[model samples]
Target: MTLVEAQIDRIVGPTHHFGGLGVGNIASQQHQGQTSNPRAAALQGLDKMRTVASLGVPQVILPPQIRPPIDLLHDLGFTGSLTEILPQVANDAPELLSAVMSSSAMWTANAATVTASVDSAHGTPTMTVANLSSSLHRAIEPQQTLCDLQRLFASFATIIAPLPGGAAMRDEGAANHMRLGSDLESPGIHIFVYGDQAPLPHRFWPRQTLAACQAVARQHGLPPENTFFLKQHPETIDAGAFHNDVVAASHHNLFLHHASAYYRADDTLAQIQRRFDDLHADGLRRIEIPESELSRTDAISTYLFNSQIVSSSTDQRPTLLCPMQVAENSCAASIVQRWIDEGLFADAKFLELRQSMSGGGGPACLRLRVPMKTRELSDLKTSCQWSASLDRALRQVIQEDYPESLDRDDLTNWQIAEKCLAAARRIQDLLAPTR
Candidate 1:
């Protein structure tokens, strides 16, 4: 099958702030209450998309989820009008106000779990927006996420209604999912890593349950043989690597992860290899970076694996799109240099996404890659795809609409909240096709 994989990244919203919302995300907590630059954050994200597009990759923007999320306020019984509700919630439950207003939706990697036609038993490309129902901050996302994607891929793809919201079916979206295909458009193994659900007094929060993974796979109709579910190492979670993506990442047929990423590194590799071999011998290209070479703390701190490996249409090796912090760290820089010398990657493109990095996200965290074939790609709402002009237009939106900065005190301001809502509507207007 001739297929194309497009990367969809969420544009940062004007209300972006250092709410430090996500549980167990070290950077989010460490950078809590810090002043945030909304303009720089969104522009940097756009710059990343532009870089990927220049490399011949099709790109799309998943516009930021509406901020000052009033949905939660209504649910919390602060009902009157948005103007009245804002002050009431701010006084009665300030923390809740902050949680709902978070810009965490910019990390669209956790937006959904996608299954390509090549990998699905039903033989149709599918998207199932995660019911990020565990943490209150993220729980409000699935509904709006579904609405935007439904509009974006309305004609071509099938989208599964989100799994019901609750702790039992806590789904962390694509961040906890990995696909390994020699060609992304072809069939490959689907690895779903969920945390230990039985019982544990672990220090950090454990997201992505096994039941949720199984439910998503079933919903997408993925063939049982090609799908693999593994228990995440509780130790890694305790160490502040909240999501699997923090320690592991894959591209094409290459799966590169830290040795401590899984519960039993060697055994997990063997099982994965066996599954791949069952399909075809030597189908897997694996690399496990040992702790001695790069420690787990450093891996999480620097986000080495969160880099996106973009393959060239030419014979050149894939370039690793990384956060500049990786190269700035002395030891990680040497290790990356060693990898380049060893022919592991073409080269590293370090991005100054300090805004995103401050919130525990990198290149990989910002996108959800969906592999589609010629027909499926064509069936997509073409207007939603990224273009040079769209980039300029979006920047114009920021200039005219988005806030320059967002701080803790701004959450309670009804006028600021109204402005945020107006700015979001303007973005929606920009996204709409010229009629």
Candidate 2:
């Protein structure tokens, strides 16, 4: 087992640990024109959540409005609470106000609603030339929201991959060129840039990513050799490939897959299949199921049979994490089903919320896990009260009377309730409060 996998086994006892997770509001007007269906986005979010839940960790939900969305999360069996923590309000001290008045009365004049003009000359006048209406800018920027969401879930020691520079700095190309320095201080934090092409023509992200990793190593008081850079095979930038890179790198193992040639759709599957075939041929009998199978039965069966045959030949067992798709399935939901079908993933209580976004990928693809010192399993059990409360809340929501059209097996109250109970129990155990 890789060091991270081992440590996680120790800390949460075979339960996986994911670090970044949040709920994205696809119901907003901004995404209406971009996606074919808003419900797909929501379904994707729920699916990712289910994936996280299946790992046996509390999937943290960060939404602007926490309560209403908690119902959907409950349906996915998330035991974590839906809570909002507003950013620290900027202080407007008298000295700061005096400075602002001296610099630009325009700002002071705009505050007239709060206070009458102090003096005609002393009072600031709003600058018509530079004044930007708040109404025009009220929409939340994805990057800023991501940073704030990271802060809110600091306890998870999460890191956020900022939106690609092109995505963040629409017009300022140079801004995107700025890479993270090699000496950052947050060990738990990592940034996963989305696009394949760097915002700037000459700049490469791998170099900057390496530097950031070094910084994280320094912060953790580890040697630079301890840090490694793992990138996706260009063609298979899908969730499974991303996670495999993370797991391999976390154990100080080099990713043998080449990104340039292995990412093609036809080539991607062939490459992955070949890798598994090679492993079997080499007498390495264990194989973990890729997360891509939740939606693809044929692929799952093929892999399972192949791995089982290989195991039988080698007298070693092959394990599958249960195939799950990051595109439309909830990690928790799929994982639960996997657990129900095969008992491969043990201790479903230590999984952490890794990454969640409106259009990118699931939690597993958003963050990377590093090997760390492990803790005893007994230290991880959570409280039963919270689980009970979550179950009650889910029951209340799903059992409510609604339009007939809204009712379906996927939306059944019983299914939601059962998942909620399982999630609550798992979460309470994972995040058990200290005495």
Candidate 3:
């Protein structure tokens, strides 16, 4: 009955582009309308998964949802086939076209909030697909994410539908959720960070609400004593730290965050430490980066805190998987070195995830962490689990089927849409379970 943490990463889709659809994400908006390299994006994602697997951790791949959402387009009153509708909509309403063709699903961190089998009262994993009701493009994600999760984990986990009541119950999934303990196998303290809707004057808005986190906790049957809800610092949200992960990351005993990550920074840390003390003998490690050292603007731009801290078999301490942006920034690089010097991490590995970084995601945003019994994972029916052969096959699909370059305008062409479909099909086929 050994439990292990597995990372489920989304394969960057053929429709990967700078749609600038994320309202609160600065990078997304800054790179809007720029040409994107789908082939390179997909390949970079695969390389990331491969690197994670090489660290002696289990890595799983989640295929991207179909782009353009043809059904939705039809419902939008676009007539005829994809060829006709795509060009017609692109010509008449380019923004709407970009929204429908978004590949933001590649950020699986927003797909769901998972309660590990060890922590749930049912003694099985529980996953709640995010509603993503804050934006039009992301709002269309829950049902498809649910379908994919059911196919992958329904055998051994309870899959909860997205919270009802739409926008009022906005949920951004695991990006706003964190589990902290001595290790993933241990029952840990669940920290749900949420934000208030922005008042007028600010263009960006916060996505995760307090109500959504409470609902997920109740649905997963998490112990009330062990679960805590914290508020995101409004100023940080306004500063483009849309999700808590942008300013904070927690792994096991390490709670790495910016000083202004929460509403009442000192009180929040005290509350977290009190809970950690109740659960374990060792103290919780807190690495708070002050604003003087690195401003919130730099934090968002460099994505320093968005790094993933994952356990490794090769070392006693967990390794920090950071985006190369952190390395390029002198201040951020020094901060990471300090973490190593303080023994917070055994070491740090900087990955080149520029494509995802440009799309407003970094190493942490690209994967969803799921803790499950090792035996259960082996018995799973889906072929999403990583294997050397499957990895090779997926690389082949990306190289052969994905476009070398694509502009937002290119999405209107019939050939581009067909190629997207073809690539998705190849990936789906590869992930289909063997009879």
Candidate 4:
């Protein structure tokens, strides 16, 4: 009857290019149209998976989906064989081609919001894929993401479809959702953070609406008292921390966030405590890092809050799996050091994930966290499971096949398409031994 938690990280695909399409992600726009090293990128992701697994946590791999969505091209009225249409679209509409080629879905943090089996009505975990319909580039991801998740988790979880595409229904997924529990085995609290939608002082977009979060909670059949909703500080969004995770992170009973992470910060914590009190779950651990300690800009830029916190096997205290960039940034480095010195966590584990970082996603942005029982965990095969063999195989494919660098114009190259498909097929072969 033991329960466990799984953190699923998606491998960045061969089509990892900067379309600069993500409206709220500053790095995507900052590095737009720049040639990306896909080979190194995928390997870097593998390295991260290997590193996190070494840290005494269960890690799972979510495969990357085929990009330049060929089916979508056909739907767009481009009639031709696969080979012919790629060039036609590339020549006529490279911008559209760029959108199709985007691999931003690799950041599965936006993939969906998950409610664990312990929290759901049917005693099955429920996943809701984000529509991501807010932008032309991301709108196409949900359908494929749903298909893949169904194939991967069919035995043990209920999957919910994305909200209907509209300004009102825009759902950005787990980035807006944070789960808190005393341990992975217990019933946990679901905290949904949202931003203001109306045209504010600036044109900053609020990806998840309060309505969307509420609908998701009900879909999962979470009790009203167990679900809490809070408004994200608009000023943080304007400063480029678009999603709640940008400024806050929660695991087990610990809720670590910036002082500016939410409006009426102390009151939000009180409300969270009240909600947790209703559940009769373990008490909450609230860690608020004052802005005076670290500026919101530094927090967002260094992705300090986006760092993953796992229970250390050595001391059983929370340990941060932070991006290596945090150590490189003087402001962030000092704070992280001080945190460790003060025993906030037993220690910090820094990982190199620059490719994901280049696009404004960090360690926390690469995965979805779900708590489930041991039997339900067996529902997935070794392909999705993390291991040294799978790790080496994926890295080999990336080194031998994935392109070293790619830019916007390369989307039209049929040869690259064939190679990309081949690389994907190799990844497919690794997952071939499912069971």
* Span of ten consecutive residues with least summed lDDT in model 2: 6-15
lDDT by residue for model 1 (1-435), tens = 555778889889888889888788889999899889888899999999999888877788877788776666787788877789878987898888778788889999999998788888767778999988778888888888999888877667788877874788899999999987765355788999898575542797688888899999888888787888867778888887888888998877678888888875466678888888677554677888888988999999999989887775654567789899999888778877887898878878899899999998988999998888867877666566778888899888888777777788887788888887887777777676531
Candidate 4: tens digits of C-alpha lDDT, residues 283-323: 77788888788888889888999998776445666788899
Which candidate should be chosen as best, given TM-score against the real structure? 3
For each candidate, what is the lDDT? 0.82, 0.24, 0.87, 0.81
What TM-score, computed on C-alpha atoms, does each candidate reach? 0.95, 0.32, 0.96, 0.95
* Model 4 regions more than 4 Å off: 197-201, 277-282, 312-315
Which portions of model 2 miss their true places by more than 4 Å?
Answer: 1-208, 230-258, 261-358, 366-435
Q: Which candidate is the best by lDDT?
A: 3
Score residue 211 of candidate 1 by CA lDDT: 89
lDDT of each residue in 183-282, candidate 3, tens digit only: 5367888999998743321556779888999999999999987898888888888888999999999887788888888886577668878988888888
Number of clashes in every candidate structure?
A: 0, 33, 0, 1
lDDT of 4 at 421: 77
- Candidate 3 least-lDDT 10 residues: 196-205
- How many backbone clashes can be found in candidate 3? 0
| Model 3 quality (TM-score) | 0.96
User: Any idea what lDDT model 4 has?
Assistant: 0.81
Over 162-222, each residue of candidate 2 has an lDDT whose tens digit, in order, gives 2233322221111001111111111221112222333321221211232332333332333
